[model samples]
Target: MKKHQWMATLLSLICTGLGMFYIGTPGMIIGGMLLMALQGAALFIFFMTLGYLGLIIGPLAIGIHIIGLIIPVLYFSYRSPRKPMFDEKRRRQLSSPWKIVVRTIIGLALFAGSIYAGYTWGSAPFMKTAAEKREVQEAAESYLEQKYNEPFKVTDVDYTWAIGSYNLTAHPEKAPELEFTLSSNDASPPAISNDTYLNQLWGQQLRDRLKPLLDELYPDQAFGEAYVFAGSDTVERDYSRLANNADGDVSQNVRLIVFADLTADNLAQEKERVLELIRRLPSVTVPGETDLTIDYYAADLKTPESVKKVEQDIDDMKGKTSTYSFRVFDISDITSADDIEIRGLE
Candidate 1:
């Protein structure tokens, strides 16, 4: 039977190369299938890393598939019917009976796998019953209490079946909501400790104080966002180090990251404003800490000249007697304006 051109075009449009298979164009069929697979993989990656704006594979994949679909439709529509759609010589080289059968089986298997993956991705979140959610909440609560010595209750549990993880949000009587994730294995505990509580409180206080000042100073250019870090070390080693050195007097290192659209014109004025703010900053009192070693960060001063001037200004300020150690940072090293880090306090 002569293959219908429109049918072939429709099939290809639906599934990259299915139309080629219907037209007995085995070589085109294989190519189309491969292209479809590649598009599917790209889409999967896009969905997986959707949080990152840089990972834009999803749109590219869609474009590629659209082009792929268009190419075959144009070829079938314009090609001379007398010349034949299936290349007999190419078919002999690429698509023997066994080869075609194997390819078909592989394609079916992959299609089934994709369907199964989609089903799992769609159903995993809704699959958890009331009893299962209760169990997960109990486990999370116990884990939190055992780890942090806090009386936290699991208020919400969110399951991401695609990643095989659970995002559990808990609430303490007098504290903010604490969020943690648990994987299927639950091999490692959620990355939270006593310092988490301290950092949260410290950050809130710092933001409340600094935000108003920033708004007042640079109403037009200020972001009014401060990335506050209040700890001596990374959270991973915090609990372990504290356990080993229970009596050690560790001074918490606090960092405040403020954003402003600084330019050459206002550079000097902005630098002086930042210095004055640093001088006026209230001492953050943490356990075993009298004063905070505050580091100020701003991204707008990216040019080498601006950075040098800022550093020089800070050094000149440091030359005089000061109550707290002050450091200035250019935003080049920071990935985001909101990113904050504390290496060690003392």
Candidate 2:
């Protein structure tokens, strides 16, 4: 049979080095087949290493295929004319039948392996175990329950095995308005910090206890909202201690940040009312801790000038000793009404 140069070139374009086999060029055929095998293997490995490894192997596989395509085209164009097409001398120089068969088999095997590898990588994300799916759902439900103080149902868990991550959709019974979808790769949900948990628990208790009294005292609700935070006093100590090795005798501090819409007219009256409210608060005692150092901050959100003045007053009192234990600040200058960072005070 006559070997057509154009047909060989077209085959090479379709499949790297395939044209060389048709053209009866042993050297070009071997080189093209090797390039094709390398490209296939690189692609398979790239899919297997989906995350960061893809960053490396992905480019390598692409480069191999590009080189494979170019090499075959160049070989066909440059060497085809010099070598006799279907002459008896050229036929004698062509590879033996057994050697061609062996090379073809090896190349086919490599190609098949690469395709299988890619298929496995693509399907991995959808092939998560039932137990893994359940774990992801449970994590989402647990997080929602802790956050909203209600029962939560995880509706769906989408596990992506390739990336080793999962996304969960949950619905809180009490809080229907809130979106409770959570995503993570961790085996379990993150633990709540001891200090934060304690602060939130104690804060809720304080709010429940003081709500009625506060409502009666301030009928007009001039005090916007009183949020009390209870946590261990990390400051007021000359020395530092590691979080795990914290001192037991360290005092527990209760800070009542009162958000009040105070104008120049009712500033003094509101300040007095806050002080009275503080005085009425019963001393709280926690086990294995010194007395609670209760402090107050009356945030004046009415005007910027009033806020600035209060800020200056706090600044002046920073180094000086005060007769009163509870302190107050006009946080009008602060944009967020919820911000009440007074613990930084000396």
Candidate 3:
């Protein structure tokens, strides 16, 4: 190859400035040196502990690549006289433009492939259907029991996964929805009639079905009574949500609520559900007269010693707390009550 060709080849190799160095261009060398310095600074920022901050600045990467290109070109332009410095053989070998193009293409392809591999590995689904099936089977076994030595089959056990609960058909067009059952070992029988007993029984069945999922997912939290929205049941509506005060210094304080439907059946089922939920939560306790209270603190900020101190303080002040009493309103006769007047006021 000719000397000029060798110089050109070297120029191409450098992509602009380094190639000019092979041809002995002093200006090109200086420009390449400056570019290298800039690249060095960018590289330092990119690899340093403060790389995150560097990215936010967003200039380091562009500076490095721009310098890489500009330095080589500037070198060739300034050192035009050195173009003839290279041997014919070197020139011929370096002049192969195809080789440079192929290398660039290969480098880009490799970069893209690496990105796709990383995303695929990081986003693969972790949960297996087999494990889910097993969990459902175990839940079914726990929900049923024999009555009077008669075997009971858990007719069906269904699974639904969602962020929150809402009634739905396990299968479309299904009727006579399977209900939840909640039971209690309270020795005294509730003063409930057959009709109310059946309704409460339905609610209980739903509770039983939900127990396993709740126990597994929310180990630290307990659910209160299932406030079902039965038709025209105003009392049930009020019980579903009572006013909560946020301005109090206690973080919580007692508030009295009055409800219109205080039937024996509703009271028994609601009580059973609330009690069962509290029993599931390890440290939670429901003051019988009040529906619920903050009995335990599992907060990250509260240390064990702090919790003990708070508990001791509560115990010491228990006797002086008669000013606050919680009344869970379960009134039965509001729908039938009305004010009556015999004469118009003058």
User: Which one is best on TM-score?
Assistant: 1
Candidate 1 residues 1-346, lDDT tens each? 3345576566556654555554445556666667666655664554455435334764666676576567556655664556554443433443456654555455556545654564455444445666766777777677657756667666776665556556666666456533323433222433322324444444445455555665666453333222233334433224323323434444333343333433457545645665555444433222343232343334444346544543333332233232222343532223332332322212
lDDT (Cα) of model 1: 0.48
Candidate 1: where is the Cα deviation over 4 Å?
A: 1-3, 20-138, 145-185, 188-195, 209-265, 282-346
**Regions of candidate 3 where Cα sits further than 4 Å from its true position:** 1-52, 55-57, 78-91, 109-346
Give the TM-score ranking, best first. Answer: 1, 2, 3
How far in Å is the alpha carbon of 27 misplaced in model 3? 17
Clashes of each: 0, 0, 23
In model 1, the clashing pairs are none
Q: Which ten residues in a row have the lowest lDDT in candidate 3?
A: 336-345
lDDT sort, best first: 2, 1, 3
Give RMSD (Å) of candidate 2 vs. truth. Answer: 14.7
Candidate 1 matches the true fold with a TM-score of 0.40
